[model samples]
Target: MRRLATALLGLTLALPLQAEWVFADFEAVSGTPQAKLFPHLESAGRGNLAAGGGQLALVWEDNRDGSPQVYAALRDLGRTGFSAPRRLSTGAEAYEPVVLGLGEGRFLAAFEQDGKVVMRVFSAAAQGPLATLDAAASAQPTLAAGKVGLHAVWGRRDGRFLRLVSAPLTVDGLKPHAGAARAVDTSPAQDEQLYASLVATAGGYALAWEDRRAGHTRLLTATSSDGRKWSEPQPLNEIPRSGTARELGLGRGPGVTRVCLAGDGADTVAAVWMDKRDFLSGYDIYAGVSTDGGAGFGANEKAQDVFGAEKPQWHPAVAVTPHGVVAAWDDPRDDSPDIWLAARAGGKDWSDDFTLDGARGTGSQDNPALLWHGGRLHLAWVHRDEQGGQVRYAQARWE
Candidate 1:
């Protein structure tokens, strides 16, 4: 009864005829093929892959040294392989690492350590920790670099609510600005907010998160002119009335989770998430776009064009390129999970779902991280099988 077939037909017609994604062979970023390499991929607010100034940076969690610790690898963008993995955390178990490329061979890595959100600045030559970003217990840290400075947001417990808090950082040393940390959400203490994604726009910044205030999980977004004050959170799943179609909205189903945000280096921002609205089936990847920064969002649309809802799609990541927006996720429709991608170019319908060319083989591919740099798409994901798990990286160019 759904219009899924028509949607797929439209998507097939939207793609560019001459352009295609050409991917290189996957290379191991973790470097240890036998050891268990669990690249931290749960932070949809940010990702484990970052690239800038002809360099690439990746961070993940692995147990190569007995206890779990955060590890990172760096390489020049023109190179095909990454440097040896470097352990960044010395004490306490670390998880959910998110990296940001700060240009000139430097990067910032943030992760959950000892119940707090901690960060470190590192390069090929030196590495050290910065002042802790949050004094209170926090998790799921995401970062964005703005014209003024760097912005960070994470979830922290405040009495009854698990709210989103933010802070500004100095660009030179990646240190938190003095007395700049504050709450970014206006919801009451009884409501819960988690898994926030952030991106810097030309005007200021935009954020998206999973909210449980309405007795059900919903996707909400907010905009800020500065990191101090934020606009009231608004729903992103509202479908306005059109010619022959009636108005509809989310909240009648299982709900939403794993929201990721990406910006087009101007005002446009996109939020992609795993939606469970198909109550009888499984989760699907959905996305909404905000043209005027994050002040308002259009009706939500499916990122994947799979007809049946039997298989589940999870762990979405998005990147905005000069052509348009591309979203990638782990899809199990083929019996084994593989990294799938779709794109919407020039405000057109989403392209038909396609798996990464080099990622189609044995083992399950999951937790994809995407970055568009130097006219190429940089991808990183975890591949696991009977032998062990490894963090793999690949690059694609549109030809």
Candidate 2:
């Protein structure tokens, strides 16, 4: 028998569900709503997308030996698929590309170029660059703009400690003042570690990263309104099973470190990450939710088991949609990492799990990126092959 929760008026109904988890759709994406310019090749780094009016803006990198270019795939949701991939980089090199759709008719894309955060805005037509922003020591760049102007944040790796810094930019690259970048958190042993996942929240934005401090590997979080100033770093999730406070032995990397912050505004933020306790289990996916804004959070709960035995899951990529919080990750239970998905109606406990098509073998399905739009879940990932790989996508519906 399976236990599940119900969805009611944006609250939990506490109902039991069916025994088995089944998927509704398993078909790959049809066509490209837009088209690509250069010879198409699979991605080497991360591929991310944002949702908008009957469309989506996909951003990825081609970090090859020749030229490293940033590309966008726009799906118009008509009789067409994604038309083609468009190259967005103009010069030198662009890495860690992040894009945000600023409602109305504005699009913001930020990336690292020449060791600086370079921001470019378009008129929503994908015509050309309307303005340029040059930020200092910017990497892992993320951008979001509103009536208050454009906001961007990145990791600053200077000196012994790696710090997270953010700055605000003018609509036309002219700020009334040069905002300062505050060190939200620091690396104590001069270890080269950084926090990567960042997104704009309601009142502000929330970021999650893996850090090694206090003699243990822990997940840390920080929030901010202006991106220049941030809240104190707090441990987002934990399970109590320790020997002693003085000599707690935490595992090494590839642990439950990466996270995704998703919710309605910044009010209901969900922190999803991977964890493995010393008790009796494998890797598990866990999440912590903040319903009353970023003030307080709920208890960290297990989301799924990688081995289908209620434990040992790894490599999760998550997204928040109107339907609920959608999480897609690779499951390495049977020596192979297959794409698995879970959904909650409006962030409640999910009814069941869904496996995806086009993900096969024991090599590497890796990160399964998810998007919920058009009343369906759009999932994409790097499907590994002997020669190389291809970016695959699928759409699934929830009842």
Number of the top-ranking candidate, with lDDT as the measure: 1
Taken over the whole model, the C-alpha lDDT of each candidate is: 0.77, 0.56
Whole-model alpha-carbon lDDT for candidate 2: 0.56
Residue pairs with backbone overlap in model 1: none
| Residue 241 in model 1: lDDT | 31
TM-score of 1: 0.89
**lDDT (tens digit, per residue) of candidate 2 on 1-399:** 122333232244543443322233332232221122122222211226566656666666664325666666666644336645566677777666766665544456666666666656543365455233445454665554433455665667666655566677555422122245656553343443354566566667676766665445677777777666677777776745554232344443324556666555546666677776533455667777776545456677666633354435666666666656767666655466667666655444653445644564545565666555556556676555454544556565554
> What TM-score fits each model?
0.89, 0.75
Best by TM-score: 1
lDDT of 1 by residue, 1-399 (tens): 011112232242334555766677778888756645455566646478887767799998888887788889988888778999998886678778888878888888888888788888888878865557787887888888877568888888788777898888764554434346788875566688988888889888999888887776778888888777898888876422342111244343356788998987688898888876664466788888778987886878888886425778889999888777889888766667888888888664997776654454588889898888889888888888767788888887776
- Model 1 Cα displacement at 85 (Å)? 0.8
| Each candidate: RMSD | 5.3, 7.0
